[model samples]
Target: MDATQQEILERLNASGKGTVLEALDISVVEATKEKVVASMPISSKHLQLVGYLHGGVSVVLAETVASLASVMNIDTARQMAFGLEINANHLRPKRDGQLFAVATPIHMGRTTHVWDVRISDEKEKLICISRCTVAVVDRPPDDGDPLFKK
Candidate 1:
């Protein structure tokens, strides 16, 4: 990875503290202009009562990486990306392994961005495929909100 990608990954990992990403143990492994990759371990925390990875967990992973990719493509000082819609299709079930999600942009417009995220097991077998649409809105002046404060 280049310097900028490393910086982006660092910032992403840092920002996950105390968030769902941290709770789910999601980590960004690669980031670039074209794609962003994240991984989560399929531990008990991520499984449902049926002993399989919960569908919600897969959706969360998809949205997180897709939103991150959209944010990476925009100027953070001036804009913010918010997920507008997301859909996921689970193809396979995973019990105990690492899941990797890769997000690639499908459409990058001035007001919106769309991304396709594919989640796979450690062996590279597709587990889920997701698409997310993110809205890019101008950032309002920070009013001491911790989320908006740099």
Candidate 2:
């Protein structure tokens, strides 16, 4: 990881958001300038009544991983990353197993970044895939403001 990426990762690791994400067994495995890989375990809450994973859960997980990747490159006050778009394709069903979501940078430009995220099982078969776009923008100052928590 580069210095800037490391700094952002440090901030995220110490931030409140990371703490909550961890409680859900979600974490980033690879974080760098143009790439990020996050993993999450599938649980009962993530499944449908038939015991298969819900489509929405996969989409949320994919979006979260891609967004976190973008956030790692954002400055807390000066700039932030927001999702511009997200698209996911579900290829198969995951009955019961630990699934991982990997996000790879597809495109990184001056104003936007795109990530390709894949959800896979222990067998390495892709269960779902997502393409996410995040827009980099100048963020307003926190200034001890309650609107955006510290």
Candidate 3:
């Protein structure tokens, strides 16, 4: 991987340390300005009571990859990406193995970005398809901001 891609992976892995991403075992395996690839294990932690992967788990993976893709394309020093909306269709039940999600941009705009994320199982069978919209916002100034006060 190139420096940019390596940087993206390092940053993402670090940020997952204390978040739901960590709990769900999500990690970015590859990334570029136009696309991102991530994966999560389909363990009991991600399964519904019915023993299949939870739909919400798929949505989280979708939003995560899409939002990360949006962030990768922006100036992170001054901007941040937030998921504005997301929708996912779970097409297959996965009880084991890892699920991979690949996100590609549908629209990349100054204020907003749209991405299509496809999740497939280890066998490359489609598990979910999702679309996510992200809003890019300027980072709030840190100086004297109550939210940033420590």
Candidate 4:
């Protein structure tokens, strides 16, 4: 990766501090204008009662990478990207190891973005496929709510 790509990856990873991303130990391992990739360890914290990876956690990783990719495509100073919708089809069950999610843009529009995210295991086995729609809108004026402001 080039310096710019490394910087983007670091920034994206740092932005997750104190959030669920940090709690889940998710980190952006690759990033570019067209795609973003992240990985999360499948620890006990991420398992269901039967010791399988929780489906919702897959969605979280999917949206997180896709939304981060969307942010990289826009000007954060004036624009914001929000997940409008996401659909995931879980194809396999994972018990341990790491889950890697790669998100690529399907459509990049002025008002919205559609991303295709494929989640796979360390062995490159497909686990889930997700398509996420992100809404791009003007950032609202700072009204003191950090949630909206950021």
Candidate 5:
């Protein structure tokens, strides 16, 4: 990882609004200015009722990868980026083996950021594709919420 990439991952590890991918042990396979790749093994813990990888799991992986991209976009500015919208479509169901996701930035601007996330399996077959938009804010949205847990 380059100095800038390492700096971004450092902040992501310290972030509070963490990914659901953590439960699956998603590993960062590649990280660069061009694209980011993350992977995880498909195990029973990640499966649903029929012994197939849960569709929701794929969505989480896609979103998490995109979230990482968004975080990297704002690390230098110390700004918070929160997903404003996400659209996902599942093309295939992954039953076993490993799943990987690649996230690339479509647009990175001052106020809004967009990312294209593609999730595939061991054979490099597309399982899910998603688009996420994050809004860059000066502070987290919890500003007006109660300090105590609800």
Candidate 6:
């Protein structure tokens, strides 16, 4: 990765520190305008009643990476991205190890971005396939609120 890409990766990883991503141990390993990748390790906290990876975990990973990728394609100073829609199909069950989600763009337009996110196990076995649509909207004029500062 180039300096800029490395910077983005580090920023994204750090941004997770106080969010659900941190709670789920998700970290962005790769990031670029064309693609983004994140990984989450499976543990008891991530499993369902049957002890398999929960479908919701896969969906979270899918949307996180897709939304992050969409953010990269927009003008952060003037625009923001939000997940408009997301669909995931779980193809396999995993009990342990790590899950990697790779997100690549299917369509990038002025108002929206569509991302294809695939989740796979350590050995490259596909676990889930997901598609996410993100809407890019102009940033509302920043109020003095700290939450809107950045």
* lDDT tens digits, residue span 48-140, model 3: 998989999999999999988987888776788899999998898889999999999999999999999999998999999999999999888
Candidate number with the higher TM-score (1 or 2): 1
Local error of candidate 2 at residue 18 (angstroms): 8.1
Worst 10 residues of 4 by lDDT: 141-150
**Model 2 local distance difference test score:** 0.74
Residues 9-57, candidate 4: write the lDDT tens digits: 7777877889999999999999887989999999999999999999999
Query: Any runs in candidate 3 off by more than 4 Å, and if so which?
Result: 1-4, 143-150
lDDT of 1 by residue, 1-150 (tens): 234766778878888899999999999999877999999999999999989999999999999999889877887777888999999999998899999999999999999999999999999999999999999998898633222347
**Ten residues in a row with the worst lDDT in model 5?**
141-150
Q: In model 4, which runs have C-alpha deviations exceeding 4 angstroms? A: 1-3, 142-150
Tens-digit lDDT string for candidate 2 (1-150): 345655555555545254546655666666665666666788887789999988988887787778777765665457667788989899999867777888778887777989999999878999998999989887776543221355
Flag regions of model 5 displaced more than 4 Å.
Answer: 1-19, 140-150
Model 3 local distance difference test score: 0.87
127 in model 3: Cα distance from truth in Å?
0.4
For each candidate in turn, the TM-score is: 0.92, 0.78, 0.91, 0.91, 0.78, 0.91
Model 5, span 44-92: residue lDDT tens:
9889999988888877788777766776666544466677888889898
* Cα lDDT, all candidates: 0.90, 0.74, 0.87, 0.90, 0.75, 0.88
| Per-residue accuracy of model 6 over 1-150 as CA lDDT, tens digit each | 234777778777876778889989999999889999999999999999989999998999999999999887877767878899999999988999999999999999999999999999999999999999999988789623222244
Q: How would you order the candidates by lDDT, starting with the best?
A: 1, 4, 6, 3, 5, 2
Q: Which candidate has the highest TM-score of all?
A: 1
The runs of at least 3 residues in candidate 1 whose Cα sits more than 4 Å from the true structure, single-residue gaps closed, are 1-3, 143-150
Evaluated against the true structure, the overall lDDT of model 6 is 0.88
